[model samples]
Target: MPNNNQVLFVKTPSASSIKGNMFLYERKNEKQSWKLADSFPVTVGRSGLAKDAHSVIPLNDNLPVKQEGDGKSPSGIFKLWKVFSYHNLQNLKMPFVQVDTNFYCVDDVNSRYYNQLILADTAIKDFNSFEHMKLSSNGYEYGVWVLYNSNPAIAGNGSCIFLHVWRDENTPTSGCTAMAKENMLKLIHWLDEKKNPVLLQVVEE
Candidate 1:
Protein backbone atom coordinates (compact mmCIF):
# COMPACT_ATOMS: atom_id res chain seq x y z
CA MET A 1 0.00 0.00 0.00
CA PRO A 2 2.96 2.31 -0.27
CA ASN A 3 2.61 5.35 -2.47
CA ASN A 4 3.70 4.10 -5.88
CA ASN A 5 4.33 6.44 -8.80
CA GLN A 6 5.08 3.70 -11.32
CA VAL A 7 2.79 0.71 -11.76
CA LEU A 8 2.63 -2.18 -14.20
CA PHE A 9 -1.02 -3.18 -14.35
CA VAL A 10 -1.71 -6.62 -15.75
CA LYS A 11 -5.27 -7.66 -16.48
CA THR A 12 -6.24 -11.22 -17.36
CA PRO A 13 -9.46 -12.22 -19.10
CA SER A 14 -10.64 -14.29 -16.19
CA ALA A 15 -9.34 -16.21 -13.22
CA SER A 16 -8.62 -19.13 -15.55
CA SER A 17 -7.14 -17.42 -18.61
CA ILE A 18 -3.42 -17.58 -19.29
CA LYS A 19 -3.33 -14.56 -21.57
CA GLY A 20 -3.37 -10.96 -20.39
CA ASN A 21 -2.59 -7.35 -21.19
CA MET A 22 -0.03 -5.21 -19.39
CA PHE A 23 -0.27 -1.44 -19.02
CA LEU A 24 2.47 0.69 -17.56
CA TYR A 25 1.34 3.81 -15.74
CA GLU A 26 3.13 6.64 -14.03
CA ARG A 27 2.45 9.85 -12.14
CA LYS A 28 4.50 12.78 -11.02
CA ASN A 29 3.33 12.49 -7.43
CA GLU A 30 0.76 10.75 -5.25
CA LYS A 31 -1.71 13.55 -5.87
CA GLN A 32 -1.31 13.43 -9.65
CA SER A 33 -3.43 11.19 -11.86
CA TRP A 34 -1.74 8.18 -13.44
CA LYS A 35 -0.85 8.49 -17.10
CA LEU A 36 -0.48 5.51 -19.39
CA ALA A 37 3.11 5.19 -20.50
CA ASP A 38 2.97 1.93 -22.41
CA SER A 39 0.90 -1.13 -23.19
CA PHE A 40 1.72 -4.65 -24.38
CA PRO A 41 0.66 -8.27 -24.46
CA VAL A 42 1.86 -10.71 -21.85
CA THR A 43 1.30 -14.27 -20.68
CA VAL A 44 0.71 -15.54 -17.22
CA GLY A 45 0.63 -18.89 -15.40
CA ARG A 46 -0.63 -21.93 -17.28
CA SER A 47 -3.34 -22.61 -14.73
CA GLY A 48 -4.42 -18.96 -14.19
CA LEU A 49 -4.77 -16.46 -11.34
CA ALA A 50 -4.72 -17.18 -7.60
CA LYS A 51 -4.93 -14.96 -4.58
CA ASP A 52 -1.63 -14.43 -2.82
CA ALA A 53 -0.44 -12.58 0.28
CA HIS A 54 -0.75 -9.21 -1.41
CA SER A 55 -4.27 -9.80 -2.70
CA VAL A 56 -7.34 -8.07 -1.45
CA ILE A 57 -9.89 -10.48 -0.06
CA PRO A 58 -12.45 -11.10 -2.76
CA LEU A 59 -16.21 -11.15 -2.21
CA ASN A 60 -16.30 -14.75 -3.33
CA ASP A 61 -14.39 -17.02 -1.00
CA ASN A 62 -14.20 -19.78 -3.63
CA LEU A 63 -11.38 -18.06 -5.54
CA PRO A 64 -8.16 -20.07 -5.57
CA VAL A 65 -5.43 -19.25 -3.12
CA LYS A 66 -1.83 -19.38 -4.28
CA GLN A 67 0.55 -22.08 -3.11
CA GLU A 68 3.84 -23.64 -4.15
CA GLY A 69 3.78 -25.41 -7.52
CA ASP A 70 0.25 -24.22 -8.25
CA GLY A 71 0.99 -23.26 -11.84
CA LYS A 72 -1.00 -20.09 -11.13
CA SER A 73 0.29 -16.53 -11.08
CA PRO A 74 -0.30 -14.53 -7.93
CA SER A 75 -3.06 -11.92 -8.24
CA GLY A 76 -2.41 -8.75 -6.29
CA ILE A 77 -0.36 -5.61 -5.96
CA PHE A 78 3.32 -6.14 -5.24
CA LYS A 79 6.53 -4.17 -5.14
CA LEU A 80 9.13 -4.62 -7.87
CA TRP A 81 12.31 -5.20 -5.94
CA LYS A 82 15.14 -5.47 -8.46
CA VAL A 83 16.21 -6.32 -11.97
CA PHE A 84 18.35 -9.27 -13.07
CA SER A 85 20.07 -9.82 -16.35
CA TYR A 86 22.57 -12.25 -17.78
CA HIS A 87 24.85 -9.28 -18.48
CA ASN A 88 25.40 -6.13 -16.52
CA LEU A 89 23.12 -3.26 -17.48
CA GLN A 90 23.87 0.46 -17.49
CA ASN A 91 21.73 3.56 -16.85
CA LEU A 92 19.03 1.64 -14.99
CA LYS A 93 17.73 3.44 -11.95
CA MET A 94 16.66 0.24 -10.19
CA PRO A 95 18.91 -2.13 -8.31
CA PHE A 96 20.39 -4.71 -10.67
CA VAL A 97 21.91 -8.13 -10.28
CA GLN A 98 24.07 -9.65 -12.98
CA VAL A 99 23.41 -13.36 -12.60
CA ASP A 100 25.82 -16.15 -13.38
CA THR A 101 25.61 -19.94 -13.22
CA ASN A 102 25.98 -19.82 -9.47
CA PHE A 103 22.90 -17.69 -8.88
CA TYR A 104 19.84 -19.61 -7.67
CA CYS A 105 16.34 -18.82 -6.48
CA VAL A 106 15.54 -21.40 -3.85
CA ASP A 107 12.05 -22.93 -3.63
CA ASP A 108 12.70 -25.65 -1.10
CA VAL A 109 10.31 -24.84 1.71
CA ASN A 110 12.22 -26.96 4.22
CA SER A 111 15.46 -25.06 3.67
CA ARG A 112 16.26 -21.84 5.48
CA TYR A 113 16.92 -20.18 2.15
CA TYR A 114 13.40 -20.80 0.92
CA ASN A 115 12.05 -17.96 -1.22
CA GLN A 116 15.46 -16.36 -1.53
CA LEU A 117 17.98 -15.70 -4.27
CA ILE A 118 21.39 -16.92 -3.20
CA LEU A 119 24.87 -17.60 -4.48
CA ALA A 120 25.03 -21.39 -4.77
CA ASP A 121 28.79 -21.64 -4.21
CA THR A 122 28.68 -19.58 -1.03
CA ALA A 123 25.44 -20.78 0.56
CA ILE A 124 24.80 -24.10 2.28
CA LYS A 125 23.11 -26.70 0.11
CA ASP A 126 20.16 -27.15 2.43
CA PHE A 127 17.62 -26.69 -0.35
CA ASN A 128 16.82 -29.60 -2.60
CA SER A 129 15.00 -27.53 -5.23
CA PHE A 130 15.82 -24.23 -6.94
CA GLU A 131 15.78 -22.44 -10.30
CA HIS A 132 19.05 -21.31 -11.86
CA MET A 133 19.03 -17.62 -12.59
CA LYS A 134 21.09 -18.32 -15.69
CA LEU A 135 19.04 -20.55 -17.97
CA SER A 136 20.10 -21.96 -21.34
CA SER A 137 16.63 -21.24 -22.74
CA ASN A 138 17.23 -17.52 -22.19
CA GLY A 139 13.74 -17.02 -20.72
CA TYR A 140 15.47 -15.34 -17.80
CA GLU A 141 17.99 -13.37 -19.83
CA TYR A 142 16.30 -10.21 -18.61
CA GLY A 143 13.86 -10.05 -15.71
CA VAL A 144 12.45 -8.18 -12.75
CA TRP A 145 11.85 -9.66 -9.33
CA VAL A 146 8.20 -9.42 -8.22
CA LEU A 147 8.09 -9.23 -4.44
CA TYR A 148 5.28 -11.66 -3.66
CA ASN A 149 5.14 -13.88 -0.62
CA SER A 150 8.50 -12.39 0.32
CA ASN A 151 8.06 -10.07 3.26
CA PRO A 152 7.67 -13.01 5.67
CA ALA A 153 8.04 -15.77 3.02
CA ILE A 154 5.57 -18.17 4.55
CA ALA A 155 6.21 -21.85 3.97
CA GLY A 156 4.04 -23.48 1.26
CA ASN A 157 3.29 -20.09 -0.25
CA GLY A 158 4.48 -19.14 -3.73
CA SER A 159 8.08 -18.05 -4.36
CA CYS A 160 10.44 -16.73 -7.04
CA ILE A 161 7.78 -14.84 -8.96
CA PHE A 162 9.15 -12.55 -11.67
CA LEU A 163 8.45 -10.61 -14.86
CA HIS A 164 10.72 -12.04 -17.53
CA VAL A 165 11.22 -12.69 -21.23
CA TRP A 166 8.84 -15.21 -22.73
CA ARG A 167 9.64 -18.08 -25.05
CA ASP A 168 6.98 -16.72 -27.40
CA GLU A 169 3.72 -14.81 -27.33
CA ASN A 170 1.69 -18.03 -27.34
CA THR A 171 3.58 -19.70 -24.54
CA PRO A 172 2.39 -19.36 -20.97
CA THR A 173 4.69 -19.37 -17.97
CA SER A 174 4.62 -21.76 -15.01
CA GLY A 175 3.83 -18.93 -12.61
CA CYS A 176 5.71 -15.76 -13.45
CA THR A 177 4.53 -13.17 -15.98
CA ALA A 178 6.39 -13.18 -19.30
CA MET A 179 6.54 -11.01 -22.41
CA ALA A 180 8.70 -10.44 -25.47
CA LYS A 181 12.39 -9.71 -24.89
CA GLU A 182 12.08 -6.23 -26.34
CA ASN A 183 9.20 -5.34 -24.07
CA MET A 184 11.05 -6.79 -21.11
CA LEU A 185 14.06 -4.65 -21.92
CA LYS A 186 11.91 -1.57 -22.28
CA LEU A 187 10.32 -2.25 -18.90
CA ILE A 188 13.67 -2.76 -17.20
CA HIS A 189 15.07 0.43 -18.61
CA TRP A 190 11.99 2.45 -17.70
CA LEU A 191 11.81 1.25 -14.11
CA ASP A 192 13.12 3.58 -11.40
CA GLU A 193 13.62 2.45 -7.83
CA LYS A 194 12.92 5.93 -6.59
CA LYS A 195 9.45 5.84 -8.14
CA ASN A 196 8.45 2.91 -5.91
CA PRO A 197 7.29 0.83 -8.84
CA VAL A 198 4.81 -1.95 -8.23
CA LEU A 199 2.98 -4.67 -10.16
CA LEU A 200 -0.80 -5.03 -9.99
CA GLN A 201 -2.11 -8.30 -11.41
CA VAL A 202 -5.82 -9.01 -11.47
CA VAL A 203 -8.69 -10.68 -13.29
CA GLU A 204 -11.57 -8.38 -14.15
CA GLU A 205 -14.74 -9.26 -12.34
Candidate 2:
Protein backbone atom coordinates (compact mmCIF):
# COMPACT_ATOMS: atom_id res chain seq x y z
CA MET A 1 0.00 0.00 0.00
CA PRO A 2 1.36 3.39 -0.91
CA ASN A 3 1.52 5.60 2.12
CA ASN A 4 0.77 9.28 1.67
CA ASN A 5 1.11 10.74 5.18
CA GLN A 6 -1.02 13.72 4.33
CA VAL A 7 -3.65 13.64 1.59
CA LEU A 8 -6.92 15.33 0.66
CA PHE A 9 -9.41 13.48 -1.50
CA VAL A 10 -12.04 15.42 -3.46
CA LYS A 11 -14.44 12.89 -4.92
CA THR A 12 -17.39 13.76 -7.14
CA PRO A 13 -18.87 11.89 -10.07
CA SER A 14 -21.15 14.24 -11.98
CA ALA A 15 -19.83 17.43 -13.51
CA SER A 16 -22.98 19.10 -12.27
CA SER A 17 -22.33 17.93 -8.72
CA ILE A 18 -21.04 21.09 -7.10
CA LYS A 19 -20.71 19.22 -3.82
CA GLY A 20 -17.63 17.02 -3.62
CA ASN A 21 -16.70 15.26 -0.44
CA MET A 22 -13.24 16.31 0.75
CA PHE A 23 -11.57 13.90 3.14
CA LEU A 24 -8.38 14.82 4.98
CA TYR A 25 -6.18 11.91 5.96
CA GLU A 26 -3.03 12.12 8.04
CA ARG A 27 -0.43 9.86 9.64
CA LYS A 28 -0.03 10.23 13.35
CA ASN A 29 2.35 8.22 15.58
CA GLU A 30 0.96 5.03 14.10
CA LYS A 31 2.23 5.03 10.56
CA GLN A 32 0.64 1.78 9.45
CA SER A 33 -2.48 3.50 8.08
CA TRP A 34 -3.62 7.07 7.71
CA LYS A 35 -6.31 8.32 10.05
CA LEU A 36 -9.26 10.37 8.83
CA ALA A 37 -8.37 13.72 10.39
CA ASP A 38 -11.23 15.67 8.88
CA SER A 39 -13.93 15.67 6.21
CA PHE A 40 -15.98 18.41 4.57
CA PRO A 41 -17.86 19.48 1.46
CA VAL A 42 -16.07 21.21 -1.39
CA THR A 43 -17.03 22.61 -4.79
CA VAL A 44 -15.00 22.11 -7.95
CA GLY A 45 -15.09 23.76 -11.37
CA ARG A 46 -18.17 24.00 -13.55
CA SER A 47 -17.03 21.34 -15.99
CA GLY A 48 -15.25 18.54 -13.99
CA LEU A 49 -12.05 16.57 -13.22
CA ALA A 50 -9.23 16.77 -15.76
CA LYS A 51 -5.46 17.09 -15.92
CA ASP A 52 -4.21 20.51 -16.98
CA ALA A 53 -1.36 19.23 -19.16
CA HIS A 54 0.11 19.81 -22.59
CA SER A 55 0.53 23.19 -24.28
CA VAL A 56 -1.82 22.55 -27.19
CA ILE A 57 -4.45 20.29 -25.65
CA PRO A 58 -5.92 18.14 -28.40
CA LEU A 59 -9.65 17.64 -28.51
CA ASN A 60 -11.30 14.16 -28.32
CA ASP A 61 -8.39 12.83 -26.30
CA ASN A 62 -8.49 9.83 -23.95
CA LEU A 63 -7.78 11.40 -20.58
CA PRO A 64 -9.72 14.54 -19.69
CA VAL A 65 -7.61 17.65 -20.07
CA LYS A 66 -7.95 21.10 -18.56
CA GLN A 67 -7.67 24.01 -20.97
CA GLU A 68 -7.62 27.77 -20.58
CA GLY A 69 -11.07 29.16 -19.58
CA ASP A 70 -12.57 25.65 -19.43
CA GLY A 71 -14.04 26.25 -15.99
CA LYS A 72 -13.07 22.70 -15.05
CA SER A 73 -10.97 21.86 -12.01
CA PRO A 74 -7.72 20.02 -12.71
CA SER A 75 -7.87 16.85 -10.69
CA GLY A 76 -4.52 15.47 -9.60
CA ILE A 77 -1.84 15.59 -6.93
CA PHE A 78 -0.74 19.21 -6.67
CA LYS A 79 2.07 20.47 -4.45
CA LEU A 80 0.53 22.93 -2.02
CA TRP A 81 2.51 26.04 -2.84
CA LYS A 82 1.61 29.33 -1.11
CA VAL A 83 -1.37 30.50 0.89
CA PHE A 84 -3.15 33.76 0.09
CA SER A 85 -5.66 35.63 2.23
CA TYR A 86 -7.67 38.75 1.55
CA HIS A 87 -6.78 40.11 4.98
CA ASN A 88 -4.08 39.53 7.62
CA LEU A 89 -6.45 39.26 10.54
CA GLN A 90 -5.64 35.65 11.26
CA ASN A 91 -2.48 35.02 13.29
CA LEU A 92 -1.83 31.77 11.44
CA LYS A 93 1.91 31.33 10.89
CA MET A 94 2.11 30.03 7.33
CA PRO A 95 3.48 31.17 4.01
CA PHE A 96 0.83 33.70 3.02
CA VAL A 97 0.55 36.64 0.64
CA GLN A 98 -2.17 39.14 1.41
CA VAL A 99 -4.25 39.65 -1.74
CA ASP A 100 -4.02 43.12 -3.18
CA THR A 101 -4.68 45.00 -6.41
CA ASN A 102 -1.21 44.21 -7.69
CA PHE A 103 -1.53 40.44 -7.26
CA TYR A 104 -2.74 38.67 -10.41
CA CYS A 105 -2.65 35.16 -11.84
CA VAL A 106 -1.66 35.23 -15.47
CA ASP A 107 -3.84 33.07 -17.74
CA ASP A 108 -3.10 34.61 -21.11
CA VAL A 109 -1.35 31.84 -23.02
CA ASN A 110 0.06 34.26 -25.59
CA SER A 111 1.91 36.28 -22.94
CA ARG A 112 5.12 35.10 -21.27
CA TYR A 113 3.36 35.35 -17.92
CA TYR A 114 1.31 32.20 -18.52
CA ASN A 115 0.51 30.13 -15.41
CA GLN A 116 2.36 32.54 -13.13
CA LEU A 117 1.16 34.68 -10.23
CA ILE A 118 2.70 38.12 -10.68
CA LEU A 119 2.12 41.73 -9.81
CA ALA A 120 -0.08 43.45 -12.36
CA ASP A 121 2.19 46.42 -12.98
CA THR A 122 5.48 44.46 -12.91
CA ALA A 123 5.30 41.29 -15.02
CA ILE A 124 4.09 41.33 -18.62
CA LYS A 125 2.51 44.77 -18.96
CA ASP A 126 1.11 43.76 -22.34
CA PHE A 127 -1.19 41.02 -21.05
CA ASN A 128 -4.86 42.05 -20.86
CA SER A 129 -6.57 38.96 -19.36
CA PHE A 130 -5.67 37.70 -15.86
CA GLU A 131 -7.30 36.74 -12.59
CA HIS A 132 -7.33 39.59 -10.12
CA MET A 133 -6.93 37.66 -6.86
CA LYS A 134 -8.32 40.40 -4.63
CA LEU A 135 -11.48 40.99 -6.64
CA SER A 136 -13.21 37.78 -5.51
CA SER A 137 -15.38 37.41 -2.43
CA ASN A 138 -15.18 34.97 0.55
CA GLY A 139 -13.55 32.42 -1.75
CA TYR A 140 -10.51 34.68 -1.90
CA GLU A 141 -10.60 35.34 1.81
CA TYR A 142 -8.00 32.61 2.35
CA GLY A 143 -6.79 29.81 0.13
CA VAL A 144 -3.85 27.65 -0.91
CA TRP A 145 -2.08 27.82 -4.24
CA VAL A 146 -2.31 24.48 -6.02
CA LEU A 147 0.90 24.28 -8.02
CA TYR A 148 -0.47 22.39 -11.01
CA ASN A 149 1.70 23.97 -13.70
CA SER A 150 3.79 26.55 -11.88
CA ASN A 151 7.19 25.47 -13.22
CA PRO A 152 7.92 27.07 -16.60
CA ALA A 153 4.21 27.26 -17.46
CA ILE A 154 2.80 25.32 -20.40
CA ALA A 155 0.95 27.64 -22.77
CA GLY A 156 -2.59 26.19 -22.96
CA ASN A 157 -2.73 24.38 -19.65
CA GLY A 158 -4.86 25.84 -16.89
CA SER A 159 -3.58 28.58 -14.55
CA CYS A 160 -4.25 29.95 -11.06
CA ILE A 161 -5.59 26.68 -9.67
CA PHE A 162 -6.42 27.11 -5.98
CA LEU A 163 -8.41 25.88 -2.98
CA HIS A 164 -10.55 28.71 -1.72
CA VAL A 165 -13.68 29.54 0.28
CA TRP A 166 -16.97 28.84 -1.55
CA ARG A 167 -19.97 31.10 -1.70
CA ASP A 168 -22.07 28.30 -0.20
CA GLU A 169 -22.69 24.56 -0.32
CA ASN A 170 -24.57 24.72 -3.62
CA THR A 171 -22.19 27.07 -5.37
CA PRO A 172 -19.65 25.78 -7.92
CA THR A 173 -16.48 27.71 -8.79
CA SER A 174 -14.87 28.84 -12.03
CA GLY A 175 -12.01 26.33 -11.94
CA CYS A 176 -10.66 26.22 -8.39
CA THR A 177 -12.02 24.15 -5.53
CA ALA A 178 -13.96 26.00 -2.89
CA MET A 179 -14.61 25.05 0.75
CA ALA A 180 -16.41 26.57 3.67
CA LYS A 181 -14.64 29.32 5.56
CA GLU A 182 -14.47 27.37 8.82
CA ASN A 183 -13.15 24.29 7.07
CA MET A 184 -10.53 26.40 5.29
CA LEU A 185 -9.39 27.89 8.58
CA LYS A 186 -9.02 24.44 10.06
CA LEU A 187 -6.87 23.41 7.11
CA ILE A 188 -4.72 26.53 7.53
CA HIS A 189 -4.02 25.65 11.16
CA TRP A 190 -3.25 22.05 10.27
CA LEU A 191 -0.84 22.72 7.38
CA ASP A 192 2.91 22.94 8.03
CA GLU A 193 5.50 24.03 5.49
CA LYS A 194 8.01 21.32 6.44
CA LYS A 195 5.73 18.46 5.34
CA ASN A 196 5.58 19.52 1.71
CA PRO A 197 1.86 18.82 1.74
CA VAL A 198 -0.16 18.16 -1.41
CA LEU A 199 -3.82 18.35 -2.39
CA LEU A 200 -5.02 15.16 -4.06
CA GLN A 201 -8.15 15.67 -6.16
CA VAL A 202 -10.00 12.78 -7.79
CA VAL A 203 -13.43 12.02 -9.21
CA GLU A 204 -15.56 8.97 -8.42
CA GLU A 205 -17.95 7.45 -10.90
Candidate 3:
Protein backbone atom coordinates (compact mmCIF):
# COMPACT_ATOMS: atom_id res chain seq x y z
CA MET A 1 0.00 0.00 0.00
CA PRO A 2 1.98 3.04 -1.27
CA ASN A 3 0.70 6.58 -0.78
CA ASN A 4 1.75 9.96 -2.12
CA ASN A 5 3.04 10.93 1.34
CA GLN A 6 5.13 7.81 1.96
CA VAL A 7 8.65 6.61 1.17
CA LEU A 8 9.09 2.90 0.38
CA PHE A 9 12.05 0.87 1.62
CA VAL A 10 12.43 -2.65 0.18
CA LYS A 11 14.63 -4.91 2.34
CA THR A 12 16.06 -7.75 0.29
CA PRO A 13 16.74 -11.26 1.62
CA SER A 14 20.24 -11.22 3.08
CA ALA A 15 20.35 -14.96 2.47
CA SER A 16 17.29 -17.07 1.68
CA SER A 17 13.75 -16.23 0.56
CA ILE A 18 12.19 -15.51 3.91
CA LYS A 19 9.06 -13.54 4.65
CA GLY A 20 8.67 -10.22 6.53
CA ASN A 21 12.02 -8.91 5.42
CA MET A 22 10.28 -6.44 3.13
CA PHE A 23 8.50 -3.60 4.90
CA LEU A 24 6.92 -0.20 4.11
CA TYR A 25 7.64 2.93 6.13
CA GLU A 26 6.08 6.38 6.32
CA ARG A 27 8.44 9.26 5.55
CA LYS A 28 6.63 12.15 7.23
CA ASN A 29 5.23 10.60 10.42
CA GLU A 30 8.42 8.59 11.07
CA LYS A 31 6.13 5.67 11.74
CA GLN A 32 7.57 2.26 12.64
CA SER A 33 4.66 0.32 11.23
CA TRP A 34 6.19 -2.28 8.89
CA LYS A 35 4.23 -4.91 6.99
CA LEU A 36 5.34 -7.83 4.83
CA ALA A 37 3.76 -8.79 1.52
CA ASP A 38 4.87 -12.32 0.56
CA SER A 39 3.28 -12.75 -2.84
CA PHE A 40 6.25 -11.69 -5.00
CA PRO A 41 9.23 -13.54 -6.49
CA VAL A 42 12.65 -11.89 -6.82
CA THR A 43 15.20 -12.08 -9.66
CA VAL A 44 18.81 -10.98 -9.28
CA GLY A 45 20.85 -9.40 -12.06
CA ARG A 46 23.46 -11.26 -14.10
CA SER A 47 26.80 -11.26 -12.27
CA GLY A 48 29.83 -9.52 -13.81
CA LEU A 49 31.32 -6.08 -14.52
CA ALA A 50 27.91 -5.15 -15.91
CA LYS A 51 26.45 -5.94 -12.51
CA ASP A 52 28.84 -3.39 -11.07
CA ALA A 53 26.42 -0.62 -11.92
CA HIS A 54 23.66 -0.17 -9.34
CA SER A 55 20.28 1.53 -9.63
CA VAL A 56 18.39 -0.13 -12.48
CA ILE A 57 14.84 0.15 -13.83
CA PRO A 58 12.44 -2.54 -12.57
CA LEU A 59 10.91 -5.19 -14.82
CA ASN A 60 7.26 -6.25 -15.41
CA ASP A 61 6.34 -2.77 -16.55
CA ASN A 62 8.71 -2.70 -19.54
CA LEU A 63 10.44 -4.85 -22.14
CA PRO A 64 14.16 -5.33 -22.72
CA VAL A 65 15.45 -2.98 -25.42
CA LYS A 66 17.50 -5.81 -26.91
CA GLN A 67 18.72 -9.12 -25.48
CA GLU A 68 22.49 -8.81 -25.60
CA GLY A 69 25.56 -8.63 -23.38
CA ASP A 70 25.41 -10.07 -19.84
CA GLY A 71 21.89 -8.73 -19.16
CA LYS A 72 22.89 -7.86 -15.62
CA SER A 73 20.71 -5.70 -13.37
CA PRO A 74 22.09 -2.47 -11.88
CA SER A 75 22.26 -1.48 -8.22
CA GLY A 76 22.18 2.10 -6.93
CA ILE A 77 19.84 4.90 -5.86
CA PHE A 78 17.71 6.59 -8.56
CA LYS A 79 14.49 8.57 -9.03
CA LEU A 80 11.31 7.92 -10.98
CA TRP A 81 11.17 9.96 -14.18
CA LYS A 82 7.77 9.14 -15.74
CA VAL A 83 5.41 6.37 -16.81
CA PHE A 84 5.07 5.31 -20.48
CA SER A 85 2.30 3.07 -21.81
CA TYR A 86 1.09 2.63 -25.39
CA HIS A 87 -2.33 1.70 -26.71
CA ASN A 88 -1.56 0.35 -30.20
CA LEU A 89 1.46 -1.85 -29.44
CA GLN A 90 0.78 -4.23 -32.32
CA ASN A 91 0.07 -1.74 -35.13
CA LEU A 92 3.01 0.40 -34.13
CA LYS A 93 5.71 0.05 -36.75
CA MET A 94 9.45 -0.02 -36.15
CA PRO A 95 10.69 2.68 -33.73
CA PHE A 96 7.28 3.42 -32.33
CA VAL A 97 7.85 6.74 -30.58
CA GLN A 98 5.94 9.11 -28.29
CA VAL A 99 6.47 11.94 -25.81
CA ASP A 100 7.90 11.13 -22.40
CA THR A 101 7.75 7.50 -23.53
CA ASN A 102 11.13 7.19 -25.18
CA PHE A 103 14.66 7.40 -23.72
CA TYR A 104 17.74 8.07 -25.86
CA CYS A 105 20.98 6.26 -25.19
CA VAL A 106 23.86 8.69 -24.56
CA ASP A 107 26.58 6.14 -23.91
CA ASP A 108 27.91 6.66 -27.39
CA VAL A 109 29.67 9.89 -28.19
CA ASN A 110 27.80 9.77 -31.49
CA SER A 111 24.10 9.03 -32.18
CA ARG A 112 21.38 11.68 -32.19
CA TYR A 113 19.56 10.23 -29.19
CA TYR A 114 22.69 9.85 -27.13
CA ASN A 115 22.47 11.31 -23.60
CA GLN A 116 19.18 12.84 -24.51
CA LEU A 117 15.50 12.12 -23.81
CA ILE A 118 13.80 11.51 -27.14
CA LEU A 119 10.22 12.54 -27.66
CA ALA A 120 7.73 9.82 -28.62
CA ASP A 121 6.61 11.84 -31.64
CA THR A 122 10.08 11.87 -33.20
CA ALA A 123 11.18 9.34 -35.83
CA ILE A 124 13.89 6.98 -34.50
CA LYS A 125 15.21 4.83 -37.25
CA ASP A 126 18.90 3.55 -37.06
CA PHE A 127 19.25 1.37 -33.96
CA ASN A 128 21.54 -1.21 -35.51
CA SER A 129 24.80 0.22 -34.10
CA PHE A 130 24.04 0.94 -30.47
CA GLU A 131 26.58 -1.04 -28.50
CA HIS A 132 27.01 1.97 -26.24
CA MET A 133 23.51 3.41 -26.45
CA LYS A 134 20.15 1.84 -25.44
CA LEU A 135 16.83 3.47 -26.24
CA SER A 136 14.29 2.18 -23.71
CA SER A 137 10.60 2.22 -24.49
CA ASN A 138 7.75 2.27 -21.97
CA GLY A 139 7.89 4.29 -18.76
CA TYR A 140 7.13 1.42 -16.39
CA GLU A 141 3.87 -0.01 -15.10
CA TYR A 142 5.51 -0.77 -11.77
CA GLY A 143 8.56 0.42 -9.82
CA VAL A 144 10.00 3.93 -9.50
CA TRP A 145 12.54 5.54 -11.89
CA VAL A 146 15.43 6.56 -9.67
CA LEU A 147 17.01 10.00 -10.19
CA TYR A 148 20.45 8.82 -9.12
CA ASN A 149 22.04 12.23 -9.70
CA SER A 150 20.43 15.30 -11.14
CA ASN A 151 23.71 16.07 -12.86
CA PRO A 152 23.39 13.85 -15.93
CA ALA A 153 26.98 14.68 -16.72
CA ILE A 154 28.10 12.45 -13.84
CA ALA A 155 25.34 9.82 -13.76
CA GLY A 156 24.09 7.09 -16.13
CA ASN A 157 26.78 4.55 -16.96
CA GLY A 158 24.95 3.74 -20.21
CA SER A 159 23.86 0.13 -19.75
CA CYS A 160 20.58 -1.47 -18.57
CA ILE A 161 17.48 0.71 -18.29
CA PHE A 162 14.12 -1.02 -18.41
CA LEU A 163 11.12 -1.75 -16.22
CA HIS A 164 12.13 -5.02 -14.51
CA VAL A 165 10.19 -7.29 -12.18
CA TRP A 166 10.85 -7.57 -8.48
CA ARG A 167 13.20 -10.33 -7.38
CA ASP A 168 11.37 -11.79 -4.35
CA GLU A 169 9.01 -10.87 -1.52
CA ASN A 170 11.94 -9.49 0.50
CA THR A 171 15.36 -9.16 -1.06
CA PRO A 172 17.66 -6.60 -2.62
CA THR A 173 17.95 -6.54 -6.43
CA SER A 174 20.85 -7.97 -8.36
CA GLY A 175 21.40 -4.74 -10.24
CA CYS A 176 17.88 -3.31 -10.23
CA THR A 177 15.47 -4.25 -7.40
CA ALA A 178 11.91 -5.41 -7.90
CA MET A 179 8.70 -6.49 -6.17
CA ALA A 180 5.41 -8.15 -7.17
CA LYS A 181 3.39 -6.88 -10.12
CA GLU A 182 0.55 -5.93 -7.78
CA ASN A 183 2.83 -3.79 -5.61
CA MET A 184 4.33 -2.23 -8.73
CA LEU A 185 0.87 -1.30 -9.99
CA LYS A 186 -0.02 0.12 -6.61
CA LEU A 187 3.04 2.37 -6.75
CA ILE A 188 2.26 3.45 -10.30
CA HIS A 189 -1.26 4.39 -9.32
CA TRP A 190 -0.04 6.50 -6.45
CA LEU A 191 2.83 8.15 -8.34
CA ASP A 192 2.20 11.71 -9.41
CA GLU A 193 3.90 14.83 -10.80
CA LYS A 194 5.09 16.05 -7.39
CA LYS A 195 6.26 12.88 -5.63
CA ASN A 196 8.85 12.23 -8.32
CA PRO A 197 12.68 12.12 -7.98
CA VAL A 198 12.32 9.09 -5.68
CA LEU A 199 15.50 8.28 -3.75
CA LEU A 200 16.34 4.57 -3.89
CA GLN A 201 18.91 2.80 -1.72
CA VAL A 202 20.33 -0.37 -3.33
CA VAL A 203 22.27 -2.12 -0.57
CA GLU A 204 25.12 -4.47 -1.44
CA GLU A 205 24.87 -8.01 -0.07
RMSD to the true structure for each prediction, in A, is: 1.3, 3.7, 9.7
What do the candidate models score in CA lDDT, each in turn? 0.91, 0.77, 0.37
Tens digits of per-residue lDDT, candidate 3, 1-205, equal 2433344443333322222222343333224453332233444444311322333544222222221243444334344554433332223212222323354433333444433444434636534333211215222333333443234433234433433345454443434445566765554454444433243333334
Candidate 1 — which pairs collide? none
Better of 2 and 3 by lDDT: 2
In model 2, what is the error at residue 115, expressed in angstroms? 1.4
Give candidate 1's TM-score.
0.96
How do the residues 138-184 of candidate 1 rate in per-residue lDDT, one tens digit apiece? Answer: 89999999999987899889899999999998899989999999999
Off by over 4 Å in 3: 1-5, 11-23, 29-41, 48-70, 87-109, 120-144, 148-150, 153-156, 159-162, 165-175, 196-199
Root-mean-square deviation of Cα positions for candidate 2 versus the true structure, in angstroms:
3.7
In angstroms, the error of model 1 at 186 is: 0.6
Residue 51 lDDT, candidate 3, scale 0-100: 22
Q: Can you tell me which runs of candidate 1 are displaced by over 4 Å?
A: 54-60
Please give the RMSD of candidate 1 to the true structure: 1.3
- Please write out the lDDT profile of model 2 over residues 76-173, one tens digit for every residue: 67678788988874565458888888898888888888878888776748677888888746668888888887777788888889998889988788
